[model samples]
Target: MKEDYAFITEQGESTVHELSTVEALIKYQEQFHTGFPLTDKEAEMILGYMEGHDYVLGEVQGNFYQGDLAEVRERICWEEYSMDDVIDAVCEWNYELVLEAEAQRNNPEDFVDFAKSQSRYERLKAEEATLD
Candidate 1:
């Protein structure tokens, strides 16, 4: 089953995690600058659920896992990699995606203006005006 994990960074950024077992989670927490909010006992219970899984070696404090958005996205859905790798990959993937999303969000007026210039939006506007 796909485990839905969540990582909340010190900056109040929250991202969804897709790791399978507790061991993977521990491994991931060990590598990253951010620590898991879970206690050791809780982490152990998670480890119990993950009996056999493979993990990729990733440095927690470095950008080794950065910019490989495609690979990261694929790893999130993969079962072969341990939960830590999955979380690391997914977090890295989302870091980039979030940047892009934030950029787009900050420029909504640009999209709105672009949409207004499109014939589709013009047509819709005219239709809506007529309904008034």
Candidate 2:
């Protein structure tokens, strides 16, 4: 599952706001001017780029599963992993996604292999489990 976040500032204070992925995408386009009517691949790339950053905008942050990691683990019955492990996994996964997106963006002939990406992500999780 994918999650989205935005940063909103009011009265000299900033807070992270969780929103649906579609809403986040729209906000992203509005802020970045990447263009309207983004294609699926383009949207994926934008999400990847967004998640790769610590702050999407001033005082606003973006990261995969930023505030919902615990719920996500519980929903998926990932009882064996610690919160820190989950955080690491999410960070690594986002980094990999961003790298893949950048690579594909730079090389038009190159295509993203979701199967490979999933396999690698699972392997990372397995490795993290074994480290415990």
Candidate 3:
């Protein structure tokens, strides 16, 4: 039988969590800055369930895992590399994507600096929208 897991949020709401381990759960919860507001004993129990088919508080069957995470890459140190290198990295990461196009279209001279903070795909979307 498949082990079941759930995340009870601070708002008295619960959701399915397929990644059973507390470490992965913690990482998942932390992604939204929505740390589980559980007691130490409850937290330990959640972690304990990682062993095998175990139970905690909430469990709902036939439910998809509610904690899918987006890729969130951090910004690289601008001072660590020369202007040329950063642009190269950004272009390589973008791969003819909108970041390269937007940067080139709006700020070619400072394209490296412009793309510096916009590392993740989600952030790139926001940056592009704001640029318009």
Candidate 4:
């Protein structure tokens, strides 16, 4: 039987937002259905697992997930990340955008070229104007 993991937010609270087994985690990842930034404890659980084993990322708002650890580390070196940063930058913006912009990759048509061209920082700034 596969071990099931639960994301327990707010520390001692008994509520679990999402739960999945190791096998299911990998399956969810392949399907792009996982979430991101994992709660503090969730990160610990992920680290406890052996490498190469499948794990699913917990999702929020249909974007951002555990797969972005590298990018998140890079951003954290500078300063704290805001919610908008997580949504637009980590989730919507990606390094692959550069490849697509350079014509080295292909993406779905609804994904706007101009929008993906902006860096996460730039996109956050532009979004501020829209919110005003």
Q: State the C-alpha lDDT per candidate.
A: 0.40, 0.41, 0.37, 0.35
Q: Score residue 83 of candidate 2 by CA lDDT.
A: 25
Number of backbone clashes in candidate 4:
6
Q: Write the per-residue lDDT of candidate 4 for residues 13-116, one digit (tens) a residue.
A: 22121323444434444455344434433333343331222322344332333422244442211122233443343223333333345442234345465345
Candidate 2, position 96, lDDT: 69
Task: Give the range of the ten consecutive residues with the poorest summed lDDT in model 1.
Answer: 60-69
> How close to the true structure is residue 128 of candidate 3, measured as C-alpha lDDT?
37
Q: What is the lDDT of residue 74 in candidate 4?
A: 28
Q: What's the best-to-worst order under lDDT?
A: 2, 1, 3, 4
Better of 2 and 3 by TM-score: 2
Report how far residue 61 has shifted in candidate 1, in Å: 31
Candidate scoring better on lDDT of 3 and 4? 3
Listed per candidate, the RMSD to the true structure in angstroms reads: 16.8, 14.0, 18.3, 13.9
Off by over 4 Å in 2: 1-78, 109-132
In angstroms, the error of model 2 at 113 is 15
State every prediction's TM-score relative to the real structure.
0.26, 0.26, 0.21, 0.22
- The sequence of per-residue lDDT tens digits that candidate 3 reaches over residues 96-124 is 45555555546545657556534544555
